[model samples]
Target: MHGPDRDGELWRRSRVAVSPDGDVVGAISVLRNPSHSGRFSVSLEVRPDHRRQGIGTALIEVARGLRPEPLPLSAKAHTTDLAAMALLQAVGGRIYQQCPGRRPDPTSPEIRSWAGIQAVPSGVRLDPLNGVTADALAVAWVAQYLWSHEAWSPVTSPDTLAQRLREGLADLDPATSTGAWIGDELVATSLVLREPDGAVTLVAETIRRDQPDGVRLVAAALARCMTLLGDAAVTNVLIDGHESDLHLAPVLATLPPTPAEPLLLVEIP
Candidate 1:
């Protein structure tokens, strides 16, 4: 596993060990969303058979020396997975947040109705994914950061923001990333990403947390994503909520969303 693969700006992932045959035995990843600095996160993986062998600890050693001033790190692990959970705790991990994974049964009448917002909020409109431009997306990022309540870095200048937007756009599946608009300003954003398992996850960002129609705008974004899904059934949706976000948890709770997994943040000492 060869990488520290410089992903987009401010991100890199590294593989610390590989077997003689070249299979990945262990790896470590570093991610600092310009939006989340002290809250930066890292992920570590070791072949199951290789655990109890101290690889996780060694990798932590490498991660502790990470560049850009050694900010705190976070990672998610399943709640019931004892080994994974224990390994993280061994390294001082704790539950900073818990985002339940929900599989929204697309056939449910409730969800079906959300596909097209019955009543879009006043003076605001949901824009098609195609309607989003780079500048608007950058603005959306700023909004997400502001509304997010996570203490991460704010985009500082036009050039830096533009570059970050370009990098983000390259990773977005435009058909799935939709926006909310007030006149020309992009006020909110949502993305439904299709994972390799064929499950689509719903994530949303609204600039104004208190907007009267904030919740509906998110629903509209998911609705548009459902349109892109076409006939393929969406059997899984993972809703990740930060401790401070006001809407996601409550809205998803209405789906009576079940607790599918417990997301744990492993604190790197």
Candidate 2:
């Protein structure tokens, strides 16, 4: 095992297992979880030929030995990856949350179903963001983000969280971003982002969960955003969100069910 190095307010380190021939067979990295203090996130990978050889367990033990806090360490495994899940569970890991990913077809009938809802419940109106910057919607983003992740991540710093949200928002494609508004208050935002890899993601969220029409309104806004994306000649928008999100789940479910590499967040105590 190697020594940890400082990274921001946390420490990160990687350890590897090598065979007598000096070929690396397995490797693991441990880093502090930014969202939850005192907890570490680990990633492990072992060569295919090295299965059931205890290399994975040995790497985890190395991570456990370098615990920076009392909380249990965390890792993510795809729900379908039984072996990885079992390995972590064998070492006392438990699934705490799920983050599902999908590439929603913009032309799907379900998505098109929302196109007719120009004004959900007949009052909420949709408007394009034009060139609005993310900082302009700080409050709504913070509320929506925190609420979506509340199950496993608690707010650590309001300012820091807001800053992080804005950073992500920086990639916001205003031309395709839409806001659902009731009069002057912006209740929901459907964002389209083009990542550094050129892959696009659609993230629609509502700060009006307290309102009866919040979810529907956001759904309509998402459709409106997609329509604009189509107009701009952009295709292949991906979406990944908390599986249990009231605002995200139903909208994602509108698409046909397909095999997806959904991840389960696991924690080992």
Candidate 3:
């Protein structure tokens, strides 16, 4: 066993377990979340051959002992992973949110049907997020994100969001990323992202809670986003939604249902 070594710059600590033969078997890491001060996000993995042993429990104990104060740990796992959920449960972890993960066909008729639909609420204009300053884009994203009613949504500030956008801008599909505006005010956005794993995703939301046509604006942006999927050469696009999502959920429901799994975010307090 080794480490709970601190990386001060990143505000993280990690531990690793190695077998007597010098083979690494498992590892765990805890990172401080920028949005939630003092709280930590945890990631753990154990080699299959080392499973059923006490390694996982021992690691959790070590994680708790890293600091004198109690550690509030947050972790994400698929509900299909029975063993992982069991371990989380053993450590007093409770489900904080349930995120629905779906992989809908990008070439579906429903998607194609929205290709030519330009009907949006009166006075609203649809446009791609090209040439938009990161600061401006982040402000718009944060506004909608806060009012999204998504259980798994994290609290974010404009600075953090801007930095994130700058870092991931290379993967952002500008041609397919659409925004809704009433004159100069951005009301909604649907961003298409190409993941490092080669998967694509469409994230759409309404930014203004008070805007009566918020949902319509989001739907229109998403519709435009779907229509441009072909231009991006995307065959599969994943979307994450919360059951209680105020606007995004309703827009997703209009599409044909696809196979989805429940992704759980667990917290240990």
Candidate 4:
């Protein structure tokens, strides 16, 4: 019963299903990650009345058909959403990562002391990625560090890294993403993404292998980002990386530990 939109842009990478009464009952967005090949993330929302109907399944079928071959799909759903959990399992999608949401206690004396300590070294410089000519290199270095240490899927090209940097930078309202430099070398980086529910999640953080001071630089950058978000009742600052990444242990000690969900990497034959 779905019909075309008058403006023709209703569901470009998504699909919409309308009931006979002209109500939009279901919708899902199919998105491709510029950094990862043959991978896609899907966001689905269904109206309450349409829940029992097979509309959700049908929409997923349509989404699958639209994807390129050897397609791999993934999504993030709340641990409490039984229906969605069921649907994803039925579609061969398993829990990739169970991130524990965390919040900052700005008034805590420990946090204050940690804040007071100069995490960044005296000689190193930290700044927002601006019109610097080495921006591409900086992005690539950070991306490589993240993929190698954090167990993230490989990002093969500098152009892909650049594209991801641009998209992530654009998402920040006050621009929280930053790059740290040791002279001309890009040594550390972090990006704070503000969720719709007012929680700021740290999406990615990477430090160069040889840069012993990179951890402090990353911590400093996150502290600055927290200040920029203001007094908005900030909750959980979620961050996840490989369990064996030792360079980040000092930084992780600063936050509360939530049980991490194991991510399964399946290569399609």
Candidate 5:
């Protein structure tokens, strides 16, 4: 291990890697996303100078040893990081999702045209995060719980899920977090958080597959978030769409996002 384990509030956990000579070389983090259930979303990184030294691999092994069992691990890599991809494959990771990269300008006319297509699915109405009541949130959580099973993830405690929502709405600001509802049932939701650098990022955007509104909820949330980011020139839009989410893959594929590498995922066997 490179340093002491970092255990943060709200169930976030991480471990670091150290070189044989006592130098910190890399690290790995696992977000036990309550929505994803059993699988942990993993990120592995090694210092550039430590390339090909097995540091990344070692870090993964360490992380796996420390995480929950029967829960397969997942990590993302870009095409530019050939070494990382190779290392992941050498250790049995396979690409599961293709994450889209950012474009130079999110405000471009072409992308601006996408908003219409991503608008609210039929029969669904959008509501601000602040207006959502506990009962409604429970409906969203239940929808997520059912979705998690299909995605092969474990459904976390309702309290944990609610806490996750609070952190998101607070971190992203309720003005930017919005949900989709049909009558009283929460069917879809999307929340965006703005980086200090001024670029906005998508935090949560989901709609129940069974709902007629489909994935259009993301469009409504996105349009609202972009409006919330008024005056900020949004040249970049970052989306992390893993392969596990089949619904998101097509959206990324159809768009001409900025010239950047797509995300690749590997699953530990």
Candidate 6:
């Protein structure tokens, strides 16, 4: 069992079971989302010897008790983790989005060039996120909202969310990170990370739902980042939430197919 201090960091209580001789054999942690209305993610780990027992199911039941009713939950399962997948499925998870591992074809110059072409709407403008301002913070929050509705893991607090954004922005090379706005209201955002071998990855991209021509706004923002990265071969851009939103699906369909990494969302009644 995790002690109080460990439990605090996990954002919820945890339960552990030990063998008769006092060997720790299984553990599970439940976390509540500090930002969203009511959501949680439960993670479990069990020792090999404890397998085939009802321990995993019991741990989930305990975690479920920590939260209120009408809970919407989700879990990320590795493609190879058959046991974990089975457990999550048994608990009522359904695969929603898949993250496909892909390699950029060197012959696909057209695709790279397409990503670099900015199609900015007449009045919208793109800019780098100024982390020190309230406006930037608002934009970041909206971006986080978009993320929360997508396949992202739950966060425990506003402070944690702020810290994550700060760290993420600081780690970004200015030339590859950017945000967009119309007049003063932030509308779209996208980020790119360049690898040592001259490959680039599109880390996260979002456009406020209220924005007019949101999809175009996001595409323009991505194009700006791609241009700034300047010929750093984009290996593959894994666009999340594409399957849930048709707008995103069309955008992703433009790219080549590769290995799919499934993301499962669950809700227990």
Number of the predicted model whose TM-score against the real structure is largest: 2
Model 2 RMSD in angstroms: 2.8
Write the residue-wise lDDT of candidate 1 on 1-269 in tens digits.
23556655566657567777977788887666554555556777888888888888888778777656657776767778788788788887767665565556565555666564435567877766676666666666656655465443234344554565556565566666677778976666776555565555666757776666677766666566655554356545665555346655555655533436655555555
TM-score (C-alpha) between model 2 and the true structure: 0.87
Model 3, which residues run further than 4 Å from truth? 1-4, 7-9, 20-22, 67-71, 114-119, 146-158, 231-233
Q: How far off is residue 262 in model 2, in Å?
A: 1.5
lDDT of 4 by residue, 64-171 (tens): 776665466656676567787777776667554434434455445444555566477777776765544445744654554555534445554457666556655444
Candidate 4 similarity to native, TM-score: 0.63
User: What TM-score should be assigned to candidate 6?
Assistant: 0.69
Error of 4 at 223 (Å): 4.9
Rank candidates by lDDT, best first.
Answer: 2, 3, 1, 5, 6, 4
Model 3 root mean square deviation, Cα atoms: 3.2
Model 5: lDDT to the true structure = 0.61
Compute each candidate's TM-score over C-alphas.
0.69, 0.87, 0.85, 0.63, 0.68, 0.69
lDDT of 3 at 145: 63
Residue pairs in steric clash, candidate 2?
Answer: none
Residue 176 lDDT, candidate 4, scale 0-100: 52
Q: Write the per-residue lDDT of candidate 5 for residues 164-265, one digit (tens) a residue.
A: 655544445555567777787666666556657765566444646665534456556655655444325556656544545544444555555455657665
Q: List the residue pairs that clash in candidate 1.
A: 4-13
Off by over 4 Å in 1: 1-35, 39-41, 65-70, 113-119, 122-124, 152-165, 170-178, 181-186, 193-199, 220-243, 258-262
Cα misplacement distance, residue 269 of candidate 2 (Å): 1.5
lDDT of 4 at 15: 81
Q: How do the residues 129-245 of candidate 2 rate in per-residue lDDT, one tens digit apiece?
A: 874555677677888877776667666666777877788877877777788888887888887788888888877778755656766876788778767666666656777677777
Number of clashes in every candidate structure?
1, 0, 0, 3, 7, 1
